[model samples]
Target: MEKMTLSSKTREAQSPTEKWMRYLGFPGGILLFLLILFLPPGAGLSASAQSGAACFALALVWWVTEPFPTYVTSLVLMFLLLVTRTSNAKAIMDVLGMEVIWLNLLAFILSSMLVKTRLAKRMALWLVVRFGHKATWALLAFLVLQLVLAPLIPATAARCVMTLPLMIVVATIYGSTEATPNAFGKNLMLLNLACISVLSSITMTGSSANLIAVGLIQNMGGHRVYYMDWMRVGAPVAILTMVLMWILGQKLLFRMKPGEQVPQVEGGLDLVRRQYEAMGPLGFQEKKAIAIFGLVLFLWMTDIFHMRWFGVEISAPFAALLGAVIVLFPRWGILSWAEADIPWHLLIFSAGAYAGGLALDDTGAAEWGVRMLFGGMNLKGVPFGLTYTVVVSVMMYSHLLTTSKTVRTLIMIPIIISLAKALGWNPLSLALPAALCIDWVVGLPISGKPNVVLFSTNQFTVSDNFKYGMMTCTIGVLILVLSGATWFHWLGITPSFWAVAP
Candidate 1:
């Protein structure tokens, strides 16, 4: 009777807190949607009131959750624009033909091939065997390995899936304390990988965003982004940020014991050696897959220089198509089509976001939002730029609001574009920095895929990641703002929407 009474009291006591937590869950998203609905028009929306309403209604739905697949959503949006006379069907569909989307799709297909061929694992094993001895050094090796792979594997989740299991194995070897050593090491490994991958993705071919950013620039400002041009601007930033992360991590977060041997790794090189030994020699199919991947990557990267000789622009989509062909070709038969379980939903999700952006453009909703946020802003002085700086800075803080950074980007980008136009500023200046800042999600274990993967080991807790991650993010933001200011100036661009009178 006493036991039953105690159970009843426990259940009763927990009910209110559960209710409170559930209510608090999606409040920010709800609030933002409400604000958009209720807010007065700023950009010529009164003139195109009906179109604006359609845009906002679509955005509200997009923001809430997907009732249909994203590509389906995008197609529906295109249909709506045509029916509403906001835009011709051709104009709505034009954006969907974006090369960036093709690049992402191809990138996914190639990544799939890599995993299927066990190439990613083979490469990782080769690196880990060489550096898996020292605990701290092993961490650095893992970071570098992932850096090399980031360009090829565009999806952070896919990257995490590839690396996380190996990291767990290494962690087990280190016998690092979950409270301090294991917790700190694991968090640092995942955060650095994810963050650095993000920084590297600024190059046009690196991530879908780079492509999207370029496309936006062309559509808005009549500028085209070339592959090498992106490299020139983004490469320096990637290198600098990578160095900062490594140096800071080594100095503060990850400490090495003096004169310690590399932790003894279990099933280490010995396992890899035995596995390789059993294979005896590379199979003909394996060789073909490798040759195909190498050729595809090389041809794609160097196509700009050898376009005439190559006789074609080797786009990411074409490369992926070739890769898929190689994989399922009867003679090669490395993977049957049935074994290749591609995540069709992700592709649709990406398409949906693309469509959503199209809808915003057609209805002039994006322009309206831009006007309200930055209309009449004078960025002639440091203070003016500083005012804009607040949004850029807060974006780093906003990572706390979502578990998925891509989701955050999808929602944030349109509003950011609107704000930039209103402020009379360059959208890329604000949007790129803000998009990059979303990577500073080191604050919680649940913050990113890599974080959650490591956290599932039950070695680290939310409080621990919060304590260290907050410090890292704070420092990272300061660096971003300072670097961004210098970069913008060097690019011969100014943030002000209108040119200051000479």
Candidate 2:
């Protein structure tokens, strides 16, 4: 028995397949780099551009395959770009200091403050205590909590971590254990996952991928998507999707039992109330954090107004930095430097990805690739509506193939921009809707961190998640298509297919 146990442990420790998978990235990247190096430079692109394209291909392979840490691959990408003389060291490093990077950094600091101050938990507890009398309303309360927290906590995984314990508690109170989940438990867990991923699109700062998308859009010479612009388009879809999910959960998907209409969770409301009271009234630090965030949000929304009156625009990153500074001030600040949960790995990866994007632009590699892929397709004459639907649909459903939202953004946005240019349509029209689809990553357990986290609760099975996720994902795509045809058309985002010649 002892020997059998040892053998089992050894087998579980590291499968040969897993070992080879991790090592594949290095050789795969090398082969791609060599292939691009040896390929003839296409017309309208320089030899240096060809090298840059090769570096990007190497980065893409490593990023997707995960032979190394994603950030490590980013470092490799920067090193290769410099060694290959595709770009200089200074140029590559400067990408780290881009405005988008700072925006993400400040956003992280702000999110950390929320976590540290316990203000997010307080708000959630208050909502649940106030409205959680019934199972359906309790589920709605949690959804509302997520909606409120999404903008403040940009990282979906962080928000999920914060709420997971509470979700487990609620499930227990309702007599929905991991071994025996009621409809209410399954609904609550799945809905939490859906809300975390879907609502991430409703604000520009709601997720790093959204900001990355904005940066790439600007790289492609499209209009920058401001916080207000994203809110205008994404808010309606988010709200509609949440409402639809609520209805589906109650009626179509997970029908609540009659007893579930009024949960008999002994002391569940009291537990939440006590938790809220234990916070002992809002602290000075929480008040200060809220004030700083409010001011920052105001400045972000009224940026154009500032430019008009003061003849100087306050960019989003500047506003965020200002807020972060106040939140970290000596006297009234909410968080210490050590407490800031900054994901330096993601920052480094983003910097390298941005640099790669710049190389693609400078070397004309983006355009060259576009021409090579679409040049022979005669797609210039395709109708705008059909193209819009196809692009949005593909972007929405593509989440099943990969898990990293950043990777999806890095790969898809540039290609979409290039395709839009090739087809002579508004790049924003195609790219923005596609960008919104970045956070719709709840279709599989590996689709996103939140999905993974929620699945671990064991209240819902994989089949449960797949059913709920696929249905909602399909609905989400329809919402995008409908908005493009109606709301986007009214906003002048989608021009008439016949307006311009091919």
Candidate 3:
């Protein structure tokens, strides 16, 4: 559940957007599926491939619209896959056994260690006390908090749960509340939401979708993507994007008023200080959480050196399992099995999404779709730079339509990779960059779980979020596009934009 969505109530058919979606989502899914199902086969698309595409369309419609609970839609997807013979029951079952699912389970266990131990809260409060003196510094502290927590906790929701109260507390102290708010509160909440998403893009374990993308790249694209390989490219781009967002949000988007710039309530800073003091000295549990998480992170980061030093490789799932093992160990561990927060539904949902993706690949649906898409664009003589811009841009902005990162990865990555291969370009050059952009689900309050949780405080409006999201989205696209031609080209992740020809 790394990059686990935080808010379960985000799409609960209450809001105006979701209300319409509720009415239209199911019928829309069925119509799309029927239309695709009845399409006259041609252009190298097989019958099985056509069926797979239809199933994907239905599942995607439901996922985006939330006509059913996302998990319920996933269940229906699995059933449709089997009934339509898009993927066999055995292949669907094997989706549960993928390392991506295992990593997700273990990552949540690791996250529970941080949440239960209160280590994550302690770190967050300490940072704010150290940096929350001013509104600007306080916002930056939360930004740093998400960055620090992204790798350690693995689950984005868990990190949000840990820091959410702290965010509310700091926002309140700075004179922002649910009923009444200010620029400071708006910036704080929105900035934290954006950072949580973009920062997760840097590490493979930061979210399940990232891991799923890696698995797809390895299995379907035939190119292995290692943890460091993602971090090596993603860390620079994501971190820089977050910093820019931090600056642009406060300076350009949501400038603070003089009165709102400082703590509004009497002794506001003192309240934060008291909370930090209430944490008392670091206890045994906090130290152990730190130690356990430290060991896991070390393994995740130093993966390339493992084959040389240990004569064996510790994959991402195994590294997490090792840490989770220590966390659940009877004597050495801090939490009981009951204490670990594992959401089996979310896990199942992830499996179904991934299974649908693999079925598309197995049936050649993804390839056929990519070929049709590229054929219409007539990319025959297009330079890689221009084509690269279009590819990453679509992946970056696709969040507006598809709310689930898992669904986005399942739908987009295979097509992007297949498109790159069709053009004789390295798949990673297109696929990995597209994967990194998948986590920028910041445009709408309904875009992600954390956005919903933060929006509950009423600190930022839909318009406020939309404006900030567009700015960050545009910035992310520009950064990826520029980096593709320079930094990535220099690093050989993207060899040359000019090398690809038709």
lDDT of 1 by residue, 399-458 (tens): 554444555555566666666666556666666656555555566544554554344343
What RMSD value applies to candidate 2?
9.7
The TM-scores of all predictions, comma-separated, are 0.55, 0.57, 0.66
RMSD to native, candidate 1: 10.6
How much is the lDDT of residue 36 in candidate 1? 51
Please give the CA lDDT of all the candidate structures.
0.52, 0.74, 0.77
Better of 2 and 3 by lDDT: 3
lDDT per residue (tens digit) for residues 27-139 in model 3: 99999999999989877988888888888779877776767766687789899999988889999899889765676577668766876877765665566578867778878
Candidate 1 structure lDDT = 0.52
Better of 2 and 3 by TM-score: 3
Supply every candidate's count of residue pairs whose N, Cα or C atoms clash at under 3 angstroms. 10, 0, 3
Candidate 2 at 462: error in angstroms? Answer: 20
Candidate 3 segments whose C-alpha is farther than 4 A from its true place? 1-11, 133-139, 142-240, 247-269, 379-474, 479-502
As for candidate 2, its clashing pairs are: none
Please give the distance, in angstroms, between residue 432's alpha carbon in candidate 2 and its true position after superposition.
11
